[model samples]
Target chain A: MKDRISALVFIALGIFFLIGALRMPRTTEYGKYGAPGIVPAFFSIMVVLLCFIMLVRKQRSNSESSSTPAEVKRAENRRLLLASAMFLAYVFLLGKINFIVLTSVFLSVTSMVFLRKRFILTVTISVAVTVGIYYLFSRVFLLPLP
Target chain B: MYTVKVFFESIASTLSNPVLLFHLSWSTLLGILVGILPGLTATLGVAILTTLTFGFPPEIAIPMLLCVYIGAIYGGSRTAIVLNIPGTPANAATTVDGFPLARSGMAGFALNVATIMSGIGSIVGAIFIVSLAPALGALALKFGSWEFAILAIFGTIIAGSLTAPKDPLKGWIAGFLGLMIAMIGLDEIVSFPRYTFGNIQLYGGISLLPVLVGVYGVPEILTSLKRVTKAEVVLDFSKSERKLSYLETIKKNALNLLRSGIIGVFIGVIPGVGEDVAAWVAYDAAKRMSKEPEKFGKGSIEGLTAAETANNACVGGAIIPVLTLAVPGSAPAAVLLAAMWIHGIKAGPLLPIQHPEMIGYVAGSFVIATILMVVFGLLVTRLFLKILLVPTEILMPIIFVLCVVGTYVLNGRLFDVWVMLLFGLLGYFMRINDFPAAPFVLGFILGPMADTNIRRALMLKNGDISPFFTRPISLVLIIAITLVVLSKYLPKKRGEKR
Candidate 1:
């Protein structure tokens, strides 16, 4: 099922690239083969073919049983989704908030969520990591942080 | 002989610098710490360090990265021996005999053997790089645009084929996807936008650092979170046999060390096939040649030694192609190539002529790093066990923050952060689907070279593709690429044909 979706995505991407290649300038000084679109067009065709091959191969393979129990699998999927959401939020808030403040909050909250029961240790470690990174980057490496 | 002189000079200079030695020790230590962790890999370590070392000069920074590479490869064996989990994919073969040895109260002995073998293997690989890489680089100087284009295609195709030996189709898809993504910015030839969709940020094209950080970093973070947390593996050091000496271990596996070292260097020189494959190959070869073949999985010292040696040796082997042809020999080497570009030096045919000292410096740094790995490996065994206790819950968040900092350091654009996020998701999905990310990276690195060279070759030939087939080097590359693709479907023979 996942393979099907991936194949469709690649096919769409290939069509999109083909359209983009068509819009690219064709009349370069060295003629059609030297045009900027040639490589992209070639890549697009290859992608479509490869994705098709993947689709065919996946179908031919024996059906694989899910290794995890349904409930455990669902829990893992939810955790992955939530973590990705948190990361997205962190990126969005990075520039607006102070670097150390935002990072500490992200770190402590993530630790709290993942560790769940270990509050004090998570808080202490979060603060320490934030400060240590700030010092290492800004003072030691001389890199300016966001 | 000239190479030998330059090599010694580099070693003397590097040893004289107290600051350089200090940095080398520190980075290699950090490399081992991360390598002992489950999700942290050599590629991730080098990528993060690449961002951190932005302020350092090329000489100090490059050595530091090499040290980390060596340390990480060796460090992975520690986890494989102690915890029965291979920290890095390259350590997978080690876990076969390593865990059994650990269970039998020979964990310390196993580690010592691994460290010594790793150092020996690295030294062999380093010798190959110093003696052979320059000659390869000189040979590459004969290549023209047509040859370069063929070489680039061959790299992408071979990487895709080898990354997932069982499923080359997915690898090809991932590789082409990377090439397609690389085409998003303005075309280098005509200075025309290819697929920007009118977004100004896309005009300059996506940066490699952010994509690397995101693809590798974000997925690592997410996967660590999903794992069922376990307390760190506790060691039983109370046994009297735990004090086994390194000299005894070395004496027992002398022949295995030499054989595995040769196998590792050869595997490392091959494009796409990395330490993981090298270790397995060496292990299998050792088993077949062993006086007691049945003892392999039952904790033979020879098995553990062969596995550890080949993987660590791969680090030096992998650098050969990167320095000579600008093509990476492994996934981590691809990042190393990118890091080289991030620094002022471009690696390729002109590398020897343009930066003659680079080979010597790299050879020198690798020697120091490998020796340091052995010294530090023996010294820091107990110390790393405690570090391994740190819960992934706390460790991963910190790593993710480093990822953000790394991506942000390159070009200082929020747009790059978005690129990282997108690629991170892509990497995550790819990982879930068993699609290889290494080839994607390989494709992205080589796409421009292939595009530019193919166009140049065509223009020079007035749109005739004949030169790509007629030229000696291009024809050889073409034939090699065909053989690689064909070999994928060919059946394996049971016995040695000869």
Candidate 2:
């Protein structure tokens, strides 16, 4: 079932990219051989072909079976969804808020989700790590961290 | 003769430099820490360090990165022995025998054997690099644009095939998807924008560092968080009995060490194949050759040594192609190649002519890093065990923040951060679906080379595609690629028929 879903996703992606490649300029100053889209078009087509083969093979295979209990699967899904949401929030809000404040909150929240028992310890460690990283990057390594 | 002289000179110069020595000590130590941590891989460690070391001079930065690379590969053995969890994928073979040894109260002895064998393996690999890289570089100089294009394609296909042995189709899809991702920026030959979607940032193409950090780093953090498990250390190293017979064991296994080291170097030289494969292959060969085959996985010292030795030796093997062909021998070597480009050191056939000292310098750095790894491995076995006690929940969040910061600092653009996130999510999705990310990365690195050279070859030949087949090196590579695909495909067909 997972293979089937992934195959469908890849097939969709390949088709999308193939259209994008087809729409790219056909000729460049170097001539038809040096067109901007040729390589991408070739690879996009290859992707589509391979994914189709995968979809066919997966349809025939009946070996995939899930052994995990439903409750465990649900718990794992919840963790994945929560972690992903946190990651998305962190990346999108990185520049809108102060680097240190935003990063500390992100880290603290993630630690809390995973640790589940130590709120104060998680917050303290998160803040300390954020500040230390900020200093290390901006002051020591001389990289400007936004 | 000149290569030998240059190798000695490079080693002597590195030994004399106080700054290099200082960097080497800390970096190798940090690498061990990274390796011992379950979710942090050698590739991630090297990728993140590449970003952090962007400000340093090439001399300092390159050696520091090499130390991390070598140290991380060796460090994974600790967790494999004590916790029954391989710290990095390269140490997966180590756990087969290492944990049983720990279970038998010989954890200290197993670790000592691993350290000694790893150092010896690295020395053997470094010797090969010093001796063979120049010849390979000279050979690469004969390659034309067609050969390069075909070589890039061959690399992506073989990487995909080997990395995803069960289903070569998925591997090919992942590799080609990476090639598609590499097409997002302006065309190299004509400067015509390909897939910018009206975004100005896409004009520069997707930055390799952000993509690297995202693909390797993000999936690790997310997966570790999703399935948080506490790993128990099986034995206290200080409490374990130290058998003085370990030295005798090492002496007896001299031939095993040499054979595994050679096997590792050969595997590493193969494009896209990494240390994990080397370890497994070497371990298998040792088991087959051993007089006591039944004792193999049940606390066999020979098995542990072969695994550890080959994986470390593979580090040296991986660097050879990177220096000679601008093609990485493994995933981490791919990042190292990118880092070298960022340092204004173009690595390829022209590298030897342009920068004669670099190959020797890299070989010297490997030797130094290997020595440091053994010294530290012997001294701080207990400290590493304590690190295993750190909860994954806390450690992962910190690593996540570093990934974000590492991506952002590259160009200080939030755009690159977004790119990293995008690839991270994709990488995680692909991981859950059993698609190998290594082939994707290899394809991405080689994408531009494939695009530019194939086009240039076509233009040079007046749009006649026959040269891709007619050219000697191109013809050989084409045949090799076909054989590799058939080797995977035909076996599956035969299995299905049964």
Candidate 3:
């Protein structure tokens, strides 16, 4: 069932790529062979074919193993989602709040909430790590970081 | 006589410079440090350090980069053995037997064996590079557009199929997905902007560094964060039991060492293939040939040695194609090629002609780097074992920040960071579905070559695809690709009692 859904997603993506390739402007000099869309079109076709095979394989397996493995708990799923959300937010808000400040907050809050750690230890470690990384990149390695 | 003179000259040049020696030694240790940690890969180490070494002279810069590249590849085994979490993808095979050995209170012994085998493998590969690079470069010169196109296809197919031992369909899909992603920017052939919906940032195409870091690093952060409370490392083994009979073991496993090293070098010489493939292939072969095959994967010393030797040897094998043909055998080698370019040294068939001393210098640098790897690997085993005790909660957040900084520092673009995040999510999903990410990486690395070559080949034939089938090398590649794909589907005739 999961494989079928994944295959459907791939098929959709492949079609999208095929459409994009077809819509691309063709150069006159290289004719049909050297068109910029050639490889993309080929790739799209290949992906769709492979996804179909995956769907077939998934179907064949369904008859053999009716039993399914345990699914992730709702709470665990929620945690993963929240972690992803926090990460995206960190990237989005990197420059606005400054590097060290934003990272410290993200780390402290993440460890405290998900890890169920002591707030004081989390905060201290978060601050120390953020500042240490900042010094290493900016001062020691001389790399510019946002 | 000529080889002897060139060899001595290379050694003299490398040893004469105090600065070069320092760079080689220091960068190697730093690289091993980076590789010991989870989330950081050898490719990332080299890419980030390329920026730092940009101001140095080519002589110092190139050696530093090579040392880091070699060191990181060797260092990944440490974490694989001690923690069971491979520090790099190449060490994945090592973890099969290495972690089992560690669990059985043989961590120190395993480290010693890994260190010795890695050095031996590296030296063998280095010898091949110094002797065969020019000849291989000449062979590469014979390749035309059709041959290159076929070679690219072969690489993608083999990499996809090999990366996923259980199911290759997912690997192929991931590889194709990567190729599709590579087509999103401007078309190299026509110079027309592709798939870019008027975004200025999309015009330059996606950077490889950010994609690599995001795909590998982000998934690690997500997974490690979820498992906050993991088992701590146990370092209670006795000093006497930890002592390894290195010379005796090497003598006993001499044939295994030779065979695995050769296999590793062979895999490394193939463009777009990497050390992980080499390690797995060598491991499988070793298990098949072992007198006690039952011991395989259950703390088999032979299995661990085969994996470590091949993966380290692959570093040299990878560099061979990069310097000779301007084609990287692995992801890290691709970055090394870029570093060479940055230092105004053009690689490929013309490299030896333009810079006569380059092959010699590279050979010399690799030898020095491998010796340093052995030295450091032995010296730091106990030290690195302590790092396994650090809680993931603290370590992961720091690594996540480093990933962000590493991506952002490449071109100082916020857009790259966004790309990293996007790929990170995609990579996590891919991993959950058991789709191999390495094939995707290989596809991205080889995409341009595949794209441009196919178009060029077509143009040469005036839209006729016959040459792709008719050319000798192209035909061989097509057959090889067919065999690889069909081998998966071919039913075994085991039950048919004839």
The fraction of reference interface contacts (C-alpha pairs within 8 A across chains A and B) present in each candidate is 0.71, 0.81, 0.61
Task: Report chain A TM-scores, every model.
Answer: 0.92, 0.90, 0.87
Q: List candidate 2 stretches off by more than 4 Å.
A: A58-65, B238-244
lDDT of 1 at B60: 91
**lDDT for B407 (candidate 3):** 81
Against the true structure, candidate 2 has what lDDT? 0.88
Q: Residue-wise lDDT of candidate 2 within B1-498, one digit each (tens)? A: 666777788788888888889988989998998888888888888887888899899989998999999888888998899989988889999999999999888888888899899999999889989988999999999999999999989989988888888777778888899888898888889988878888899998998888888888899888888873456688565564855686698898988999999999988998878999899999999999999889998999999989999999999999999999999999889889999999999999999999998888889888888888989999985576687876888898888888888888878899988999999999999998889998899889899999999899989988888988888989999999999898987877799899
lDDT per residue (tens digit) for residues A82-124 in model 2: 8889888888888789999998998898989878878998899
lDDT of 1 by residue, B303-373 (tens): 99899989988888899989988888877787788889889899998998898888877888889888788
Top candidate when judged by lDDT against the true structure: 2
Off by over 4 Å in 1: A58-65, B229-232, B242-245, B490-498
Residue lDDT tens for model 3, A1-146: 76788889889989998999998766557787878888999988999999998888625344333342235344546667877888888899988898888999988887777767567888999999889878877888777888
Write the residue-wise lDDT of candidate 3 on B330-449 in tens digits. 888878887888789999878877887788778887888887888988887568667666667667777787788878876888999999999998889888777888778777766787
Task: Give the lDDT of residue B17 in candidate 1.
Answer: 92
Once model 2 is optimally superposed onto the true structure by TM-score, how far is the C-alpha of residue B312 displaced, in angstroms?
0.8
Tens digit of lDDT per residue, candidate 1, span A1-146? 77877888888989899888878888776677768898999999999988887777626342453656788778888878778888899999988999999999999998888778789989989999899999988888877788
Top TM-score prediction, candidate number: 2
User: If both were scored by lDDT, which would come out higher, candidate 1 or candidate 3?
Assistant: 1
